[model samples]
Target: MTKINAFTYQPLTIPSHTESVSKQNQKPNAQKSSFSESLEEEYEKLPLKLSKHARERIDERDIHISQTEWNLIHSKMQEAKKMGINDSLVLTKDAALVVNMPNQTVITAMGLEEANTRIFSNINGTIVINH
Candidate 1:
């Protein structure tokens, strides 16, 4: 019987000249993989959480929020809280969001275009975010 050497195949990969400098040039933990992660972090820092009704309303209304918007809202909410405001009318260029600051959840949301010229009462405070 003829005996041959055991076969071991190695695939060729062209070597890359990338240096360790590439690693240094990159910022540590610079990228976030998901929006949920950052949102969770922000939620943790703030004692705020969305109500089921609020969440449903957002979905039903197809209201979307960016990270920047959320940050702005959080800041405004903090201000409202300090001023002893409970339900706050938050007016942004794109959205009219009602947030229950004490409850730490958004009550409902509407498009600015739709909410334009509409009156909102019973809110102890109103925050108009320009730009």
Candidate 2:
């Protein structure tokens, strides 16, 4: 077998001024851009589909009240009591208030002022009302 030198097989280098031409013809980073870019064109169009009714119907749950509603209810209950309604009861979603009648027997038993304080002290929520 005849052996030829490896250097003899290589072609001579051609020094062409192709920098500008090469830069102009450079392809965009197709792989990198496709992964990172937010272009909506590349995605496949979704197929037409039927909308199914939700399996579980939403439960009609009781809604909670805000601080304002609590104050309003409290004021309304007090106003109703001030107008001479005896043993009145206010039933709210989250709270209830009962105003006991000013019985002469109970007044004699527990004293008027102390009983009044105990009756009016039935308040709810962290925020205390001025009235």
Candidate 3:
């Protein structure tokens, strides 16, 4: 039993409806980040090796890809995998790359100027990215 006015006032406790919704939202986001991170780690462990010919082309062409461009290329390749693509021609703002998807190898690379002038053939898929 309890007295209404004899002691200090008390209030009833309740939970907000948004509390559960917010928790559910956080869970999926956390899982997605963890899953992606693990996938990247596994990918990094396996070499995304560049062929000797590709290296020579990069050196001769003087094409430089920044870290951001590299990450974008990495992600685009993952997307290509889902689309049943093997050899891909990736056209980026700064550079063009020919990637062998299964082996995660870079077959060749060149600057945009070179790519624009030349025709890319024998590629199963083409990927375009901002940078």
Candidate 4:
């Protein structure tokens, strides 16, 4: 009968001297560009994400927002984040959205009519889109 151990451990291997030297010699700009490229790729993957509550509200309230409008909202949200706005109220022709700028998430949404009757709190900025 052969006995087997339940766990196995592997020793950590340190980088060879030449490997460390090559890494130290790499251009800083090249490293920065690669990191920035990866960040851009991640940003592109999720331009916007709607929370479950936001989606529910959108469907329940029958709000219609076009893709172009969403793109514009996303760009504006990025600008708002740069300006240190974490929570924002976005007013559009047909709908209103509360967005978390840093996370690029729509927290909730409502029709323009409903939005007009309600008070929005904890919002640092507002973006009004005519289109």
Candidate 5:
């Protein structure tokens, strides 16, 4: 296993090969490949993720959000985060999304019509996106 320095964020590689019976007491260490490291970096760079409940709500409501619209929402959410918004109600042309800014997660989603009659609590900001 590769250990990372908490302060430096650098990978500490351990010896992959172990010695014979003379060093039997020592624990074996597995080396992490560069590919795996790159994969982890890419995963960390993802902008947002949908919680299970949010995915269920979107599917149940038959909400259709295009990739372009999703990109816009992510960008706007990042801007909102910079402004000290923790939770936000994002209103798009057809959907309403309650997003947790710091975690970059969508907590819930619904159609605009359904959102209009509902009340959102615990939200510090609201983002209105036309697309």
Candidate 6:
């Protein structure tokens, strides 16, 4: 998109040499490198330690859930398996505990429908599991 001035002088008349080593030796402009260019070209390159330290930090923050919560989560997981449902499964209701069990929350927050199924029961009051 360069705009050429009509008043500029004519093009150079020298026959261009394709194999000239002197022409090849000319340095490229440093500012126009691709987005994925290596950082070695500038002072802004990430230090080698940064990536290693980030991975170590992530490893340290890996968390484990309580056993009781884990059991509930596992049971819900099995139900999903039985239904042959994937992450895209749709639920008709909002999975919520507002009045009596507001303190309880869905163990695994996957899909919206799965969340509803995990929190809701047809029978009200305390859940009575026969198993």
Model 4 CA deviation exceeding 4 Å by range: 1-46
Q: Which segments of model 6 are wrong by more than 4 Å?
A: 1-59, 86-131
Candidate 5 vs candidate 6: which has greater TM-score?
5
Per-residue lDDT over 2-72 for candidate 1, one digit per residue giving the tens place of the 0 to 100 score: 33587666666654745665765564435543555675565455445766676666667777777677788
Q: Per-residue lDDT for 1-131 in model 4, tens only?
A: 33359666666667678777777778687888898788556445556998879877886898877778888999999888999999999999999999998888999999988888999999999999997
Q: At residue 74, what lDDT does model 6 achieve?
A: 39
- TM-scores, each model vs. reference: 0.58, 0.23, 0.61, 0.64, 0.64, 0.21
Q: What is the C-alpha local distance difference test score of candidate 6?
A: 0.32
lDDT, ranked from best to worst: 4, 5, 3, 1, 2, 6
Per candidate, the number of residue pairs that clash is 0, 0, 0, 0, 0, 0
Model 3: lDDT equals 0.82
Tell me how candidate 5 scores on lDDT.
0.83
Local error of candidate 2 at residue 39 (angstroms): 54
Q: Which tens-of-lDDT digit does each residue in 7-97 have in candidate 6? A: 5556656656745845564435333344225532321221111133323332343322234433553354345445543322212122211
Judge candidate 5 at residue 32 and give its lDDT.
39
RMSD of 5: 15.4
Point out the higher-scoring one by lDDT: 1 or 2. Answer: 1
* Cα-based lDDT for every prediction: 0.75, 0.35, 0.82, 0.85, 0.83, 0.32
Clashing pairs in 4: none
TM-score of model number 5: 0.64
Instruction: Supply the global lDDT for candidate 1.
Output: 0.75
